[model samples]
Target: MLGRTMYALISLSDLENDFINPYDLTTRLNRFVAVEYGAQFVLTAALLFTGKWFLGVAQLLLTAFLLHSWSVRQHVVDATDVFRQLPLQKKRRLIMFGAFLFCFVMVTYRLIESIIHGLLTDEGRETAKKLFQDAAASLHHY
Candidate 1:
């Protein structure tokens, strides 16, 4: 199942890169998967299990690390350009702004993606609901 989802995502991304609209690719994939598998669950039960939070966090951290590396490379390029032509004070300020923007955009994108996925995906939504209910029940019992 994990392989299937990974393949689907990769294929969709490839198609999009090839100028095919993702919506069309997604719809076609959905229909094909539905007919072939009878059901489609993009996220698995394991993904929603409480024990997998660490895995999810790790994945997020890995993605952030990768993006940070790319951002740092871009900053280096920009800084080289600016330092060559701009005043030292102006270059410092621009570098600071670049760092701030990189962190802000990376964090915001991760947060928004997580929230949107939690809202849009059944596994995430169900897991959240189950967690809330369990907490409430535990409180009542107490």
Candidate 2:
């Protein structure tokens, strides 16, 4: 469902650029963003409800990723506005750095979240307790 909505939005965007329908274009774009937000919201809710602590962390990181992507898109547009003023090589380098930074942050966030989840969750504590009890019982037998 999300994929189909995204595809339809992309198709409508292409059509808008080829032709001209300012009103419909704006409406379509708004709907697209709303749908994306809805999908994110649903995923987050699922994570919270299912006791999937890792998934919650991942969802938070994904939100950051989306924000970073938005920032990069804005930066690219701003760079284009000063195309003649800025050096082409410098602009290219900045864009590449932005892309790399975005990905790096996303991956780092995921890893950190995963580690934190493993360390802090009740499930981990319960597992540790069971392991300790099992080991103690074995030692007593010996």
Candidate 3:
């Protein structure tokens, strides 16, 4: 399950970089900003609901980075130039990427700690139960 979850996350990212951007679907997808922000918020909620608030926060930070990137792209005066980043902007991008690495490390640490300590709060158990029920109910409708 852990391997599958990691694969799904990586695949989603690869969907954009390997396929979406290369095929120039970005313009079609960005027809509405809601498509971008809506996804981030929903995924963040899912992460939080699963007792993974660190991942949720990391998703939010990624959203922030995307917004910053979009702002930089929008400000470009040259029509043909695409997302031309200034040196400082490039540095900031690196910093944000580093932050992502830090968040991933924290997530890994949390998972290991949970496994070693076997500590699940009552609230977390309840949330997990409810989430499982909801997913099961939704699956039945399909």
lDDT of 1 by residue, 1-142 (tens): 3344444445445553565554554454445443323221212223335454644454444345434544654212132242242243234334434444544566578789788775667887888778879999999876
**What CA RMSD would candidate 1 show?**
19.6
Higher-lDDT candidate among 1 and 3? 3
Best by lDDT: 3
lDDT of 1 at 129: 78
RMSD of 3: 13.4
C-alpha RMSD of each candidate structure in angstroms: 19.6, 12.6, 13.4
* TM-score of each model, paired residue for residue: 0.26, 0.35, 0.41
- lDDT (Cα, tens digit) per residue for candidate 3, span 58-132: 777776776776677631222133234223333543554565566668878988878744766788778877887
Instruction: Using TM-score, give the best candidate's number.
Output: 3
The TM-score, computed over Cα atoms with residue i paired to residue i, of candidate 1 is: 0.26
Clashing pairs in 2: none
List ranges where model 3 is wrong by over 4 Å: 1-43, 72-86, 119-142
What ranking of all candidate models by lDDT puts the best one first? 3, 2, 1
- TM-score, ranked from best to worst: 3, 2, 1
lDDT of model 2, residue 5: 38
